[model samples]
Target: MVPTIEMTTTWERTCELDDLEPGWGEVALLGARQVALVRVGGEEVYAVDHHDPHTGAPVMARGIVGSRGDRPTIASPLHKQVYDLGTGACFTDASLALRTYRTRVVGGMIEVELDA
Candidate 1:
């Protein structure tokens, strides 16, 4: 049997890193999905679904950027539901979860790896 090779071509370029403001979230369109690109500090970035799981509203980009202890978090602007930026786990509601995407910065450009 031949060895299978993993491909890293799923990463899609979204926007320039300079376009994002630190401690704020920006909305980016990746194909048919709306992703929220969040910039923390300087180089640290995270990508999560722009849709709020609780209200089904595409307003996550306006969510407040904050932290719960060491874990980075975003609080929904509507109901103030907190979610982990790393794991997309809902801290306020155990039953709700936001989708997370892998993000990387290359040559000052931000790329997001969407789920297949």
Candidate 2:
């Protein structure tokens, strides 16, 4: 699928706030896109690609969530590559990165703004 390059887009409800847990992740389907949703603490929610770019495996939802310095991160289960949950920057490598979605909570539901 072609990715849209527009400046901004509408927010889509991905899941309920109760569906996630801290230090863990879940998969959410956004049309053809597969996203990994994770709840850190309080009402903070983060979204990234479910597929790991390094291993080409759809196991990012099972990745371990933690912090690398000041950035929250998810380490890939396959190769132990740490990726920043906020910016999707791979801490293990400067060349690799994950796609992060903008997330927010509204009325006890989680919403993500997909790039368009």
Candidate 3:
């Protein structure tokens, strides 16, 4: 597992827009940790910790993505746990949440922000 701090701040290229399939997520190693790169919607991508904070399992990537009152979040497949995409806070339980990384499109490539 890679440190959450490193993955959150480092920029890594996981895949291209056409390379990612909708409704699915891919795991990438960032500075010794595994992170989930998800294609939530059309041309929209998100990065989150592969591990589910609620179950302690690396399965957040397999979760579904949707919005809850304008907030983007992923629903864990293990226990149906919901987490905020921007802040990585568990919606169901504020205390439990996986870590999220900063994602953006730069020069037509999807990049994740890693720690400095």
lDDT of 2 at 12: 84
Model 3 lDDT tens row, 7-96: 334578876777778768788877787899888677788888998897788887788878799888889988898888878888898789
The numbered model that scores best in lDDT is 1
Model 1: what TM-score?
0.91
Quality of model 3 by C-alpha lDDT: 0.81
Candidate 2, after superposition: displacement of residue 115 in Å?
A: 2.6
Cα lDDT of all candidates, in order? 0.93, 0.92, 0.81
lDDT of 2 by residue, 2-113 (tens): 9986696878899889888888999999888899999998899999999998978999999999997878999999999999999999999998999999999999999999
lDDT: the better of candidates 1 and 3: 1
Where model 1 places Cα greater than 4 Å from the true spot, the runs are 1-9
Model 2 C-alpha lDDT versus the unseen true structure: 0.92
Native-to-model Cα distance after best TM-score fit, residue 29 in candidate 3, in Å: 2.0
Per-prediction TM-score: 0.91, 0.90, 0.81
Report the error of model 2 at residue 73, Å: 0.6
Ranking of models by TM-score: 1, 2, 3
